[model samples]
Target: MTATMRAVVLREPGPVENLTIEELPVPEPPPGWVRIKVRAFGLNRSELHTRLGLAEGVTFPRVPGIECVGTVDADPSGELVPGQQVAAILGGMGRTFDGGYAEYTVVPRTQIIPFRSDLPWEVLGAVPETLQTAYGSLTVGLDLRAGQSLLIRGGTSALGVVTAVLAKQMGATVLATTRREDRTAALAEIGVDHPIVDTGTVAEQVRRIVPEGVDAALELVGTPTLPDTLAATRVHGTVCFAGMLSNQWIVRDFYPIGYIPTGVRLTGYSGTSGNLPPEVLQDYLDKLADGRIEVPAPTVYALDDIRRAHADMESDQVIGKIVILPISGQR
Candidate 1:
């Protein structure tokens, strides 16, 4: 009999109930790949899309986790020693191949970033995908720099919080916005220079604060908000769409030729290997270990409770990252 491992499998792409714990064969790393003993992994909106059949070219009965932090159990190429600690994210992980929702997962050795960190499982697991998106959107998409002004269009979302922290750490003045007026106070505590209650007038509110608009904006909320994010940037500034928390992927009537202002660049950072660079994850981990940066503590669940975790994420109240620890009891 083949060796087996427990994984949260998506037998069919439908509702959250379709995700169930199943005993799956332990996967082996093919040539150029490495196998990891998944200690902890973070859930993202992309995985939800994969589960809903919204991710094109994705087949059913998949293991849907986009990223993880774990120990490299085997590396066939001898690039990384056995038992090496590593973090990996977004190299078609949960989309084209089995992913970290299992006790073990395999990826190309190039997908792994071997790192040394003493942080606990929940924290490490929570950082990879979140930090990758934030780092990529700010550094690459927005060309972020010190002394600039930034607007995070979805201040209460997980990505928004991390982006504010990182952009602040980089010496940028941050103005964050949320649909609820109450969350702005919380944003202020996290170094947000100004927080706007995201009424229908996000651009108008931001202009009141920064006058000429911000240097850049990170749009976490989807289509309904991207236009406003673009309008909130200064001439020649950029806007990067990094997440779709609104759950809407398409922007109807999007005529960029006329809609996007001249000299105001529009870019995006998908959480792919190209966006989530390995050195970027390493750099974030190093800062995490040294106390220079912080991520909200993860709300952990055993692999058994994976369904409930997803249900909660779909709700309006998930304040931080939700993590699954396979070694812990099933949810």
Candidate 2:
């Protein structure tokens, strides 16, 4: 490999034009870190927010990718070896540190998980962020159980879709909301049962589906949909706030006594808890490898075409996960 590698760097927080490809010295692994030749990276909404100067404390001229799937080039800690495939999820990646929007990246060994060789590189990139977030939120935080019901707002998003799939796998009936009619059909193909169009009557529709209201609701659409989610959830049910795609308004009209009487639980989820505890992530990966669970990779882009990928992600045109291939290989 060359001593220098090409990387897409955001020279300053502006538009996609600010992102440029440049040659930089390849990074070496630190004590507990491994150097990776990145095969693919996954795009998240946080990247766009950081690029547009919306995310605070993000420095300029930074690489902005949250998740990556790559082969280890050097493992100084010996916990991983060269040529082994692995996946990485964002903790401080693309936020407080340099990220995976490059041909190579160095990640701490503790943040890396072994990738299943049976899955494609693009699929591997799609897994770390979305699956870990979904799994951790549903099972660990919300304490979701079998025979329960869940309502997921923004069902077509990468994390939302993964949450829906995992809910089904855990034997929970899932009701999801999508603004686009075309996406509803695709969501159903991935195990979502009730796909509601994001109309003003979303709560009513959810009520019709589960008359007692849903046992839980995953709030990905943020404030605009929070009211509907709150209205649709059953007494004593949990509402997991996983994403903030819509508005960030906090509900003020409702009295605390209302929820107290109803016994509803409101909570937030962040996947920064160290990649789903290894063992659970391994079990999920095993299921993915054996076809017991389907983790979809909806779009793939070459590393050079990263600007277009980010644009598509910001526009919400892509369905599941948008993958950036560092090596010009097919999915």
User: What are the per-model numbers of colliding residue pairs?
Assistant: 3, 1
Q: Kindly list the per-residue Cα lDDT of model 1 for residues 151-182, writing each as its tens digit.
A: 99888777888899999999999998888876
Candidate 2 local lDDT, 209-293, one digit each (tens): 8997899999888777776788888888989888877536366676776643267778888876374676776777788888888
* TM-scores for every predicted model: 0.94, 0.93
TM-score of 2: 0.93
Cα shift from native, residue 170, model 1 (Å): 1.0
What is each predicted model's overall lDDT from 0 to 1? Answer: 0.84, 0.82
